[model samples]
Structure formats: structure tokens, C-alpha cells
Target chain A: MIPTIKNSKWLPLCDVPVLDPSSWRQVIVQNVREGDRIAALFGCTHNASVPVRLYALLARDGQGTLSVLCTDVEKDYPSLTPECPQAHWFEREIFEQWNIIPQGHQWLKPIRFHAPYASSTKTSPPIGEADFFQLLGNEIHEVAVGPVHAGVIEPGHFRFQCHGEDVYHLEISLGYQHRAIEHSLIGGPNKRTLPYMETLAGDTTVGHTTAYCQLVESLAGCTVSSPLLRLRAIALECERLANHIGDLGALAGDVGFLPTASFCGRIRGDFLNLTAELCGSRLGRGFIRPGGVAFELDTSAFHGICERLTSVSHDARSAIDLLWNTASVVARFENTGTLSQAAARDLGLVGLAARASGVKIDVRKDFPCGAYADEPFPVQWGEKGDVYSRAYLRWLEILQSIHFIIDKQERFVPNAVQTQIGNLQPSSLAVSLVEGWRGEICHVGLTDDQGKFAHYKIIDPSFHNWFGLAMAMRNQLISDFPLCNKSFNLSYCGHDL
Target chain B: MIKSLWTRLKQHHRTIAFPKQEPRLPEKFRGLPSIVQSRCPKHCSECVTSCPTDAITMKDKQPHWDLGRCLFCPECSRACPHGAVLFTDDYRMATRTRDNLVIGPKEYGLAQPLEDQRRKLFGKSFKLRVVSAGGCNGCEVETNVLETIVFDIGRFGIGVVASPRHADGLIITGPVTHNMKSALEKTYRAVPDPKVVIAVGACAISGGPYIDSPVANNGVGNLLSVDLYIPGCPPHPLTILDGLLRLLGRRYSTSRR
Candidate 1:
């Protein structure tokens, strides 16, 4: 049963009484629009997907609900887009995937990867539009950058509509690194399909793997061994710490502090080594198995790990202190790419990206999974929502993560992990939200004919935050592009895959 | 001023004669895969399955681990619920045979003389740039640590460069993804001719476990010629540093300082 935590503005309106397979959609045509008052237009997901949502808040009027005016009705319900502007991306994404016609929506284009959704047949028809985000500009010169870039970077194309240095309306064209990981997961057995999911993006292995497994666990209505959950969380946090340090160092490097960057990179590298020592895979790739973990952290190994982490932490702290006082490094990140809290929320920014901008929403804290469900560590949040703020918060979060690791590892006993959950029956339908280093990782899973996965959709925080990144880059100089991009550190492979 | 002097003092005695001597490896070091016969469950196929890049293949029923393609992710070992595939503590898997690199029960022997190899490698220093294709990041992490103060790869004249143009050799990591293949080619192309390419980690060498996937692009040499290859999911840092040292013309020496 989907438990109701609290009555929220949107939850009640959208909640289907019972979410059976057929009841995949909660609201019918009449429920799409409330009354006279027009609400905001949000986003929607589609194809290789189940239901197409025309999500709009209704007005609190005669029906005493949130009201929204919709001019164009699909099936006798007033349209929603004219009321809300934010729904544009969702509409475009839906149209691009499922071919749902959003009556009065603007700027319908591809959001995920730039592809023709899937192979089209003559009768079903392929939706073709003239240059989707092809909003033709007046005398605007188009500058194309990267399917391959200069920095140790992922492949993405940024077509900027700029005059000189200042970007006017920026268009981010990513999908160059599409691995098609999801489609490949279908035929294999549960455990065999996992390793592929594990490498969706190397860096996000544990986070994505954890989310994937957790969803399956939830769907199967299976409960994991406690030790396994704790270990998963610990491994995930370590991965988060490692990535945060690397990005922080790289961001500093982008700002021209080579020494600071090198030091941070070195420390981050040390953390990765520690991961290999404890788990055997530096990036925690094989750490997560379908039903539960395959290995255990030996006492001596944990001690060695804690010792190494302490040494690295000390070395990193001294270096960070040096970096903080270092005039050059501090000057580079401050006051750049200022994303206000309201703007971040409005844009649906998540994870550290949103927290950096002052909207503190950590799934670990808010939703509470694994060890975090029991622990009471404070979540680090920043208000400036700028490059510096994000970097600083990342540093603070790294510290918190390290503390969590030590605390968790210290409490771990040998032979504490007893048994596996004998049965991994495919789950009915489940959604697992974990706070990945990047942000909120929301995964939805449903079983297929033979009780295997019918569909599994992962919304990496970067998917929502990519638009925010483009927005953050707006009005900023060309030089700060890498800095702005690094703040988010969105995974192109994870997104593309 | 005071802290700068302290850092300088710490840097002063950070001497490591890597080519002249070997260094310690971490416990979970993702070095080149050496198939241990004693540990193999014999009938288990978990390691073969755990591989995301397909660097491991079963040959005549026994596992044939191609070092040229292994990602060094101890996923095989970790995924071995039965402890069938294991990552041994032995970090010295360097050999002359490209075939010898595909270590399994049949190919676990170390063939190279370290001291002489070290002397040959320490002949000069070389800069390297490490790029990951679709690896689970085991290799990239180890590559990143080559410069840590302890096993300073710089002592062997091996440094990591950001761009391929500045690099004397390219240390390619990960299972070759379709996306990274072009970038790998472009990076190789950008590097001046006569530059060496080193496929570090099992994934780069042979796609680790992900090769057969729709995403992988077979081997590193499938696109570009690689002079030397370091196998491991994330090969032990010292081993990686040692490989770079060997490639820079230094001989590999197992002598401890």
C-alpha cells in the first residue's frame, strides 16, 4: 500500500485511490482541471512509459480545489498550459516520446536524448516537426560546441544563441553519450541484468544500482537484510563523498587553482582507492546485487579503511584550509551563477544542486532510507545558490558523509549480516527515491509478463537540473561555463543511458 | 607563510624510487585479474556475468580474462557469491605476452624481470592522460591516485595531463562505449604521432564485461594501437605507476626502498 505521509497541495489531487495496474492513472479527464483559477503547468514523462499526464493545479473554487484554466481540452476538460508556463518541458518531453498532443503548449521539443523515440511504423506514424527547439532567432549566430570537448569531459553539444560573450537564449544539445542501457536490461534474468544497470554511468554506479535494486525490492515487496541496507547506504555515501571531492577539486581547477585542484583530485583519488580496498571496485560497481550485497566488510578491512580515510581527511582538510585562505581560489568561485532558492524550486532543481541554491531537500533526510533512516546527521545547505555556494556545500556534505561512514563502519560487527531475503519475487509497482550525490534519484519499476521488469524509469536529478544549468549559464560569461557546469556535475551517460 | 613551509617540508622527504623499487598496494586494490584456480567454483558463471564490459570470457570452460580488456573491478570476485572468481593480492601480472595478459588458471605466471624492465623504463619521464569510456570508474580512480604523495608517479616521470596533445601516452580506462570510441579516436588523433597509448584496466583492454553489449566497442586496439596495457578494474595505483614508469623506458624493479 502507498502510505500517505501528509496531505500536500498536489498529492491528494493526483493520488489514485488504489494503484492497481489498470489504475496507473489517478485523475480522469474531469480531474485535470479544477475550476476558474488557472494553476501552474509542470512537466511530464513518456514512452517506454505507461501513462501520459497533463499535470496542472486546479483552482480552489466551487470545488474547493486548486483551479486552473485550460483553453484546449483533449476530452472535454479545459487545457492547462495557458495557466502554467513550467509545463512546457513536460509537454514537449511527452510529445517527443508518447506523441500526446498538448493542445496549447509552446516550444515542444526533445528533452532526454535527441532521438526519434523509437522505430516508427507507417500506421502509428512518426512525429516530425521543423527543428523542434528550432525557435528561429533574428540575426542570431549559432555557435556549436562539443560532441568531444577540451577538458576531461563527457560528450555534449551546447548550441548557444549568443551575441558576443554573453549567452542570450542557450540551447543544450546532449545525448552524444547515449549507451541505451535501459533497453538492454529487458531480456536478461534479474541478477544478470543488474551489472549492466550498475554501469549506466560509472560514477553513478552505486547510486543508480541502489535505486534500481531498491525499486525491485519495493516492487517485489521484499525486505532486504538490515546489514545489506546499511552497507548499501555506506557504500553509496562513500561514492557520494568521492564524487563530491573530485568535482570540488575540478571546479577549483577550472577556476585556475591547479595546486588546489591537484590536491583535491589526489585526495579524491585516495578515497576511490579506499573504495577499492573495502569493496573491491573503486567506484562501488559490484557493491550492489539485486536481492542484497554479495560481500561483507571484514573488521580488519573496515579498520584499515577508517585509518586511510582519516589520513586522507586530514591531508584534505589542511589543503582545503590552504585553498580557503588562498586568495586566487576563493576569488574564482564567488558570486558566479547565482540561482536563488525560489528560482531553483520553480525550475524543479534537486539534490545538492537545489540545496546549494538554498532549497534543502535530501531524500536521505526527507525520505530517509538505509542508515540515514536511523542517523541524525545535519544536512548541509547553502543560500547563495551560486558556484561558490554549491562548491562550499559540497565540501561540507563531504565532511558529513565521511562522518557517517566512520560512524556506520564503527558500529558494524563481523557476522552481523546474517541472511538474504530468500525470495526476490518481482514487485507489483514501486517508487524508490534516494538522495544521490547529484540530487534526488527517483526510480519507478513495474513487473512484466513473466514477472520480470516490464518498465523501469529513472529520473536522475540532472535530468530536471540540466535546464537549470542552462538557466544558470544565462547572462554569464563564456569563461565561467565549465565552472557553472561543474557545479551541477550532471552525468551525461546516466542521463543519456 | 608558516603553512607553506610545513607543506614544503612535507614535500621535501617524499622521495620514492619506483622504478628502482616497488611500493605497497592497498587491500582492495583493483589490479590486473589473475584467475586463482583454488578459488574458482569451477561451475559458477557469476564473474562472467558481473562484468559490465565483458572483459572476461570463458574459454574451454575455464575463464579467459583478457588483461587488455579487463576493467579490474573485482566485480567478478564481489559478484562471486560462491567466491569463485577472486582478486589475489599479487599485483605483479605484467608480462610480454599479450596473450599472457588474459590471465586465468592457465595464465597466472609472472613472466617479466622487474629490475631490468625498471631500468629500461626509468630511461626517461613521460606524461599521460587517462580517459574512461564506459568503465564503472574503478580504473579512473586508480589512475587519479598515481600522483598521491606516497607512490608519486612523478618520481618515475609519469604525470597525468588533462589534454591528449600534451600527453606522451594515453592511459585509456573503461569498457569502450560507443560514445567514447570517437572521443578516444579523437584524443588519440590529437596526440602527436609516436605517442604511445596505454589501455589501463580490464575494461579498456577488452571491454571488461561490457564488450558484447550493444554499447561497447570491443577493444582499445580495435580503434587505436596501444603500446602497453595495464589490467585491473582499477589496477593497483603502484602497479599503474609502475606500468607508466616501465613505459617511460624504466625497468620494473621489485626492490623495496
Candidate 2:
């Protein structure tokens, strides 16, 4: 039986007994096949004599348990991708970071073309220059787009192998925005650390910072006040509301639905404005600190937000409803880019994209933390994994999130905002999973013997779902690529980090 | 179709009346930061230490803040016991010269428009190609906001085009990453001669938080000559709009009566 840690904030890495490499692989493969998703898989090197220690964090959604299984490996180990397809990227990442190869792992490629952490033997290949799977037939032409695009979007390369208008395969190559954020966090909880977490993924500032703060607080054995936790939940849901609204607007824009596109865009700013009212920044930066929150809401400020939220919610609902009622929008959305439920499960997709594929997994509901533990939100899913379902799922989530925010506002109690965070426990590991607007944002922090961060692993939801976007494009029309892409709206920098 | 037309008509003119009137910013919105030199204690490094981006430096024993490099987190303001650093709601922080970004005790003016021949050539209609080398999508989204109904930058005859070849200038964002260095250079080269590069946000000016990172080359300033520097962690849409308008020698009358 794999040793399980109840989802809190931090757990001692030593409490998770290190097994032999073979047993570790067996445990992970068996558990993952039995429904557990690999949350994070990373290696940490401590001493010169000791081998690199590998940690596998498995999130058993049904049980609300996070099981930690670790092993010490010298060079290489048998691959788990053949049995569990979710292990494909994780194994490749392990290989890229430590020079330990995953034997028998098919489709071994660098996830991020960065220099290896431990060794200097193999020079890192240039970004987006890796060998991609090519189609070898007449009429099987390739179309490459970005690290730069027409729209003012983040940089990431997309290679599509197409037969006429129908796309046979699409390979997304990122790492253009890999800012060495994780590497910078080592031995740091310093002033620079929180700022790094805030901008880890700019749009998901609250989500990532919350995860980082939670991990730090958990490591320090500190619990924040209920009011602060409630406010954070509200801010997080506000972030959700804004992004979902913006995404819905973007989806409409993709289909040439002008009314919803224009209206939703302005309404999105309204929600962001509400966040600005809470904190100074629209993106919710510097609001979520280590122990708790940086700001507190006064009565007038609180009521102002409540009043603004009501109007924005009404306008947003009206704008989004037009999307469903309009035939042209629905026609473009439905069956455009579909990912099967089986494929979603195989790929280990999370968040809204996963839910759209009928996979009932939400970090907030499954593994409740802070306010979620007290007042949980319902799990919303869609049967069809098409662009339409994803759009509809976002709309559904927007309504639910609005209701959640309004409800939280009514029940909010004024109290101390931030608590004092003590020194972190040495040789401990903390895993924080936040359901960011994009999806599950996992930050795993392992502290050294000196109570400083030894290795920091940040697994953005984009990491799991970017592959799902690629899978969705299979047999899809080339023109619908933009629509399918917007439905996902995966972060380039988030994945790159 | 009639109902849609009526709906559109009822919506009326939704664009913010800028260049004829000042835009409305939220009360809590942070913009230009002003430093009070006298309030700073002698040899106290509180504000300097609290600054995340190292934007604040002590020169002549007075803390000078580089707006281009600032994330505007307000940590320095909170860290200072004497209340030396204060942020104003004035969203006009963009500047023409890099030195102008370093604010001491004295007040600084807005970025002046180009006096070159290219300004007159492109003043009527300036098309820009935006390149996000290593942006976090904050600046990208805000830059996109300029095209939306409320902002609607097209009225000024300034718009973002897809290709650099068809553009008059490049409005670049993000810290230039090593991976995107070649792509950014290639895109810049594609733009015709007499093109200006306007670096937006702190990242594009000084790499923001990711400045000394091995993976990043700080900002586009290192690679290209920046004509205008609009500063913010991610500059508010209004700040960006004002910067663009000011750069074209067009200023909106203040709506305040």
C-alpha cells in the first residue's frame, strides 16, 4: 500500500518511505491505472554520494487523498508511459532535468529544451527545434505557426500536419517563456520569491500565489483566519469569473459573434475592476501573501464589490446567453474539435477541459482547502468534449462562480487578515493544488536540511491540458484550429515554467 | 435582424471619449509613483530592501525609483515607516527617454511625441506589430483591451496588424527570452526602416521580476532602441492609450470640470 498523506498543506518527505526503483514504478503504474492521476513527478538531488530521489505525487480524486511514493535512482528506470500514458511527459521531464533516462519510454522528447539540472554532458537543444512526428504522404502538407502570431498573444510554436483542410496531427512546442522561475525559487522565500509567484502566470496571479502561499504556510505550520481564507476564495472565484467571461467573449469573437464578443469584453473588465477594488492591481498581485492576504475589505468597500458584482453578473449572463441562442455561434462551436472521454482520461486532463470530456475531477471539490472545506461548490461537467461543450462549460462555471461569490459576500465575517508565518520545517515537502481559472495549478516545495527550498516544482494545468489540445486537433479542420485553441486557452508561460 | 439593429442602436456610442475627454480610471488603480525624499530616513535601506524588482536605488543618499523597472507592488510604500514613497492615480507614466523614468524628488512630465520626419509620415495612421517574447499574458491582455469596444484605438487610426511587414512600428512586450530572441530579431527585421519600437510594461523595459534570470535577456531595450517606455507591472489600458496618444502629439482634454 502506498503511504498516503491527508490533503493539508505540507507533509514530511521522510514520512513517505523511499522504496526501490522497481517497486516505486510498480506502485505508481498500478495506482494510476486504478484511477489516481499523477499530480507531480520530480527528482531532487541532495548529497553527492546519494542517488537522485524521485517523488511521485498521485491525486486519488475519489478518496480526496494525495499519495506520495518515492525512489532513489542512479541512472535510469523502466518507463510507466506504456501502461499509463499520463507518465509520458513526466518521464520526459525527469530525463530532461536529471540525466536519468526512462528506459522503454516511447516518444521520448524534451518537454522544455533547457540545460539539465545535474549533468553537463548533453547540451540542451534549441527551443522548438526538436524532432517532431512528420506525416509522409502526398497531400499531407505541414503548416507551422508561432512562437509569434497575428494576435497579441504569448509565444509558442504550433506544427500541424494536414491532409487538405483536415488536420491529421498537431504538435505544440513551448518553452519560449521558460523564465527559470522554479530555479530562482531554490533557497528563497525571500522578497523576490513572492513576486516570482505573482507573475508565475500573470493572468493566474492569485491562483499561483495562493498555491505558493499555502505551500509556505503549510511548511511553516501556520493557519490563517477564516475571513482571510474566505476573501481569498472570493478573489479566486472572481479570477475564475473574469477569465471565463473573457474566454466566452473570445470564443464568440472566434465565431464572428460580434455582440457577445464586444459586450463580454467590457464586462470582463468590470470583473477585473472588482478585483482592483479589492486589491490595487487588476490581476490580484501582491494580494495573496505567505500567511494570508495582504489587504482587508472595509464595509463600504465590501458593499461596493457586492453592488458591482450584481450588475456585472446580470450583463455577463445576458451576453453569454446570446451565444447559446444564436444558431451561427452554436453551429461553429459544436463538433468542431472533439476529444473523447477515453482520450481525456488517458491524457490525464484536468479542470474545465477535463470536465468538458465528462471526467468529474475538480481540486476544489475533491480536495477541499480553506473556504472550500466549509462551503463546497458543485462539480459541473459536459458530455461532449467539443469546442461547444468547453464554451458551455465555461458559461455554466461563470454562473456558478458568480453565485459562489455573492453567497460568500453575504456570509463574510470581518477578522484579522494575515497571520505570522514561522520558519519552515527542514527536510519537509509541501504540495499545494489550486483550481486556477485554467485548471489545477500544482506547486510542490521541498525544503532542504536548512529549511530552505531545495527543489520547487510548479505544474501548471496547461502542462496536462496542452496535449489534450493537440489530441483534439486530430481529424479537425485547419480553419477550426483557432476556435479549438481558444476553447483551451492554455498558457504558454505557465507550461514553459 | 431588426431586433439586433435596435439592440445595436440602443447601445449607442460605447467608446470612452478620450483625446476629447480624459478616461475614467478606478479609484484603487495604481499609476505613477512619486517619492518624498525628505520623508526617507538617513541611511535607511527599508524601501530599497523591500523593492522586489530592485527598481529603487539610493543615489546621493536619496531613493530614486526607476518607473520602467518597477512592478508597482507598493511593498516599498508599506515597508517605509516615514511614508517616503507614494503612488498617484495619474496613469500618464510613459516616457521618451530612459533617464526620465528615474524619478527623484522633482516631478516628471509625460513622454513627448517624436519630432522626426517618420512621425509626420506615420502620424495619420500608425500600424504596429506586437511581439510578446516572454510576457506572462498580463501585458498582452491589456494590450488587447485597447482594441475592445470601450477603448477602441482604431479611432486614432492606430491598430495592430498581423505581420511586421505591413506595420509602421513594433509595440513589444515581455522580457526578451533566449528561446524567443531569434524570433523577435527576425520579426523586428521584417518591419520596414524608420520604424519605432515602443516597449510596454516593466518587463519590456527592464525585464520586471525576471531581470537577472539566465533564461531571460531582461527586456527588448537590450536588443533594440526603444522609442517609448510605458511602465507598469502590466500598464493599465488607459496608460497604454494615453502613451500612444501622447506619442502622436494628441492629448485629450480633461473631462473634469
The TM-score leader among the candidates is 2
TM-score of 2: 0.97
Residue B119 in model 1: shift from native, Å?
Answer: 14
True contacts kept of 1: 0.33
Q: How large is the interface RMSD of each prediction?
A: 4.3, 1.4
Error of 2 at A295 (Å): 1.4
Off by over 4 Å in 2: B6-12, B252-257
In order, the first chain's TM-score in every candidate is 0.82, 0.98
Chain B, per-candidate TM-score? 0.71, 0.93
Best by DockQ: 2
- Indicate the residue-level lDDT of A276 in model 1: 66
lDDT of 1 by residue, A1-497 (tens): 33222101112222423233122122322343321221223322222243433333332222323332212212222223454333445456556545555566655555544343333541212212135243355765666676556544556668666657777656776554555555556543454466666666667778888887776565445667677777888788788888998887788778887656767766776777676665666677566766677567778877778888888888777767776777777787888887888777666677898888887666676666666667654777998989989988988988888888888665776544423433334423345667888987766444444556544555667676887888888788876888988988887766666
Query: Which residue pairs in candidate 2 collide?
Result: B19-B252
* Per-residue error (Å), model 2, residue A126: 1.7
Every model's DockQ: 0.30, 0.73
